[model samples]
Target: MADKRTTTPAGPSTSLQRGKACLRCRKRKMRCDGVKPACQQCTKAKKGDACEYDDGKGKTRTQLMREQIARLEARVKELEKSSSSSSHGSPPANLSLSASASPTPFPLDMDSSPWDSQWNGIPDFPAVNGITDSYATEDPPIELAQMLLEIFLPHRHQVGLEVHVGRLRDSLHLPLGEQRHPVLMNSIYLWACYLSRPGSLCEHEPLYLSRALAAVNDAVPNPSKVIDFIQASCLLSMYFLSNGRLLEGSYHASAAASLAIQWGLHQLGSTDLTVGVIPCDRESTFRLNPAKDAIEQGERVLAFWQVFNLDRCWSVALRRPATIPDSKHPWTSVITPWPQRMEDYETGELEINSGSPTIQAFFVHQAQVSPVVGGFSTFAHRVKASALFEGASRLSSSWYPRLSSSPSFTENFRAFEHTITRFTTTLLPLHQLAATLPDEKTSLLLIHSLAHASMIHLHQPFLEDQGSRETAVRAARSLAVVAKHISDTDYDYLDPFIGHCWVLGSEILASEIAQLQAAWSPHPASSELRVELNTLLFSLTKVAAKFPLFGYQATKVQKLLDAI
Candidate 1:
């Protein structure tokens, strides 16, 4: 009999219909169910939001790849236009940088040629450089520039950048030829070298450094944007400090503050402070058109705090008067509110003129106050710590009247002790630091370290007293813990002020070690003390090797120990 059964049609088509897969599935070379909104695999993976599909135009994989490439190229050109072009636009919401609040170790294999490294992302263009006269140098290619800039963005805070990063990134996308002013870019490139592992990138630092200084000088006479000067000066100052160039570093730091003061950044959002004497505008003061939006206003806010931090911390480091005045004079008084993050400005959370006094409140024995009710807690705490550092530095000087322990001095000293106690023991205590978010670790580390260092400085001049010695010892132990924490990590960038603290810290520990050695019998805690001392010295040596600013002090401590 003839077979009536019909053979089943081929089980399924051998080929996939083009454009049938979700984008993520296509990238992963997985089968797609073609579900709307999300595919079954993506939904199961909980990546529904990331799942996407092209229109069913039957485009090939190569065509989709080409489209993505074209889109990326457009973004680069757009950034190039922003970097050097005259037109200013409101920047996008976020940047490509990862963990900007505190940077983690970048995964790049620094020992390899940077050319071999993959393009991580675009620059967020934080204004962060140096000098007079143009130093001609071969410019890096676009690919290399992107890589180096990507390296700089996440660590912008480490370089003291105080600009609106999104806006700055918008400004940074211009092409190399259009970059008539490369001051900020070159400065970033130089630091990219400094921050990278010892490798080919490090070799180009001088070239970038020279060009950065030249760029600064070239721009000084006719800057397209004045804020770049202030931001560039900050990085230059930090760069010099790292290289152990004290005078140059101080000069740049003062210049940054002076420029900020002249720009009226110190008095942003207010002009009504009453003074006994009338004020007159100076020719050097550069005024800007009213900010078009909140981001520009926020940049102005950050510029002031950037200078304030440099002035306060460097003054303590140098044991000299800070250049940025904090007096009651109409022209010189700093009335700007404590800085809020760029987001606060973007979200309309800040009340500009409502902030009464920042440093003024600190002078009256109150913590510095920010306009935003609860702004970046880390920044506020750091600002308070900076004030404490400045006060402690002043009191440690032999000529400071506070050294005499007069009734007024005693009162002020006790007040400082109380504030420092609260800072280290209550608000943002060190023991709880490990629980902080990853992005906040470095800043919190700096805050606790600075607080304890302030305690050491406050008690150092009176170490002759048993009470003072005990207090200083206690603070030194805390500093050791912080240093040990730092040693455990691989952070390539740190503020110059931290190095200054390490110098003082190493000195105190060295002194204690010597005293113990001189005793006929070993102290019961001798082994533990040696371990702490070794840890501090090890960290100090590591830092000094990388940053020369602390080398002289580290050498002194090592020599002192050798003699003991």
Candidate 2:
């Protein structure tokens, strides 16, 4: 596969003399034009050095840090073994990314676990015929598709922020009853699930999960609604199951599965097209069904929850020495153990409402705030002038290189540029809103959103830039302060996940910044920052792994003792 590269400008001419060297020139250890994007010298060489991105080996923080640490440890072992000839020692184990303990040891085995029943154990959805045709027209409605383009076409970074923050509970001031927006409700549940801290299943699960489920129930009956409700229920059930609420959690999970099956069956026969109001021509240029997407997405969620529960159950079963021999207990002797599935954890690609006419309205409604636009409906229409922000640039032009050959690319790109200008220019107000939020939960929500966004942007395949790294680092610093305060207050639940997320995010961005540091020949002070960042990553990793709820305190203390 061709490697994705961020677009940079062409190089300058050899005739153009300048002080600052172009990146191409510098990489080749030659002269630079200092002209933005491209320089004349590199362009003249036909080097096509327009790709200014440093892939940086694309190594994740965990992978890079582990390799570095392993090398250091090997050196230490070599020295120690040479000094003491008559000693045998085992290598140290790698540290886990769970929680740590304080002076007292953390009890890791207090929670009960139950094995989740498979689909056959519960009621299964009866198979349906003629279902293939339903999935054939998997496009968004023309208007909604256009709207999605408009709202998301410009200021994609801001749009990403809206999508993510809208997922957390604190972002919306609407009461539980009033917070009926599908995007907001679904996002919050996912955020809570992603943000679970050590031992947080006791409190945080109930608060957010209950509220989210309520909002899901309040939404219009649709496939998306069923998926959201079922997914949230599964998360809550998993939390409850971990906390030893077997009967209650099992009942809830079972109910959720039943509902999901019904919805899945319904989706096979129906079309989803209700999020928009305006009618388009009968010709189906674009048609989208969020509920149908939800049905498939729900299955993935269900499988994940099942695996999590099954793993917990197996762990519980293995807590004590097994008396049964492999021959006697064949089920227990299954060869392959369940490892965490990475794909299930990241839902960035799910197209819940693709190409739907209502999606344009959705973005307009999302970007709407009181006084900034008239009423909610009016707010959506006003943004409609820009096609709700969708333009050509937001579309992955490179995915279909043929797009550039068509004149529409130029039109869409220009429109997208305008949309970007409008959205980016107004984001300061959103930042202001975040700055003024007094409620700790709300504040944490804002900070968490910012932190997640910064990290995501920094890691984006095609969009990783200095601005994204800077944004991530700054957000992490600010969020750390707020998280500290929240931890000290009644809103302690906000602290645990916030710290973990911030540390992980900061480490990733900081590592990338280190690469950029090489190009700028940054000052000694900046070098010091980079050094301290290494220490920060280690300390934060230790602290996050020791968190009381999810921290696996017993194992951590054991590792700490070994270190000492």
Candidate 3:
């Protein structure tokens, strides 16, 4: 067939031979069928344009990458030097005045600022040198701020401390010289320190807390700064509670509630035409438009709930009555819509309606009918559960002394029980699902644990009746199981509020075990109860290893167990 095998090309051999592969193929460690314009591998990858060969006169690809990296390193050094030089310049004198006049003034850029040094591990904070005045006008060290935020942000939503993440991040980018709310900054730092690696960051807790406390103390009297004051107060309250400083926490919690009422946040959605108008003044205008942006409005809604949550939670944690009574004047008069996820407000999915039904409306409506699906937030569920638990605590405390003499006690008790049952039925499927994201899981566990705890509190006094005692025991045992599961799987990720729930649930479990031991005749359930209590205690100790407050409480439980 025309000499069958075609004559071989004269100049170059047709047989493929390994030559210098294209740079792309060499880098990828793939064999290249060295074609002139483009290698077969590159062509097949659709990266023909990227197929480059070493010209034999230039550096290799590895050398080129090294040179480029060196250039980038040099550029970074130059920028750092420039930033260091610029930060020494005096800041604008009107910065403080502008901050005061503008409800939400944008801060100066952090680059080319003294605070930039903090990010590079340089000590830029004046407080680092023991100068306090510099702190009043400067930002906290950026490194410290970042570390604290990293520790706190993940836990914030779970604890009902949802600050506007976008706004907070924006504020952090401001130059140290720019004026910002000290209370907010300090409160954030304080909590960050409290939640940081226990021994490493704990020392900063008192310093930041003192600053936050001082700022809030001064801001609370100024009507123009009421919003800042309330926010700081809420943060501090939670900080104190997490550290087991109940009295101080309660004080700040009560103060936040007072501020909420004083600033009329509770009435933001009120449509009562009978409400009288105050004279229009600068302060009044500020109060009316404090939430000038969507972020601030979302913050206001969240702040109110934070205060409400604290009031409800601590009432049971401290064995005290809830300060905010349901259906009471200001409590029921709140006109602000129930808080939504921060993302919803940030993305404009949720619009702030001027006359939306208040959170109180949902509670009132829920009391008379079935809970509306998606009517509230996971936070609202926690608040509702806490309120129910508080009611149970109140009933138990007041009625325990004269259970038989209180003729109406049984009816009131039944009503409370019915309310709890109704509320449980309204929980979102996500809240009850076994598998969820870490944050959702923590919320779910807390809500269910609190509900079970409320049941135990409501029925423990009625333990004289066989049915009531079994119900109480069952609830307590369920709570122990839940606690054990959470500690087993989510101990490291649990919120600060979880520690409070753990304490409550563990105590009940421990009490039940103690009672079982004290029985004249060993009950068939004793061994099972003992096993559950041991598992729960083991989980609590694991949790305590992380949180000192839980550690303290866990130790107390351990002692009780030993005695039993």
Best by TM-score: 1
Model 2, 318-361: lDDT tens per residue? 22111211221322221111111122213433222222222232
What lDDT score belongs to each candidate, Candidate 1 first? 0.63, 0.34, 0.59
Candidate 3 stretches with Cα past 4 Å from truth are 1-134, 142-144, 174-180, 270-286, 328-332, 347-374, 400-407, 428-434, 487-489
After superposition, candidate 2 runs with Cα above 4 Å error: 1-234, 237-359, 362-440, 447-459, 463-487, 495-504, 520-564
State every prediction's TM-score relative to the real structure.
0.70, 0.30, 0.68
TM-score order, best first, reads 1, 3, 2
- Candidate 1 wrong stretches, greater than 4 Å: 1-141, 174-181, 271-285, 368-376, 398-405, 517-520
* Model 1: per-residue Cα lDDT over 342-411, one tens digit each: 6577776554454355676664645434433233456666777887887787766633544475777778
lDDT of 2 at 61: 28
Error of 1 at 175 (Å): 8.4
Q: What is the lDDT of residue 511 in candidate 3?
A: 72
Best by lDDT: 1
> C-alpha displacement of 404 in model 3, angstroms?
3.4
Of models 1 and 2, which has the larger TM-score?
1
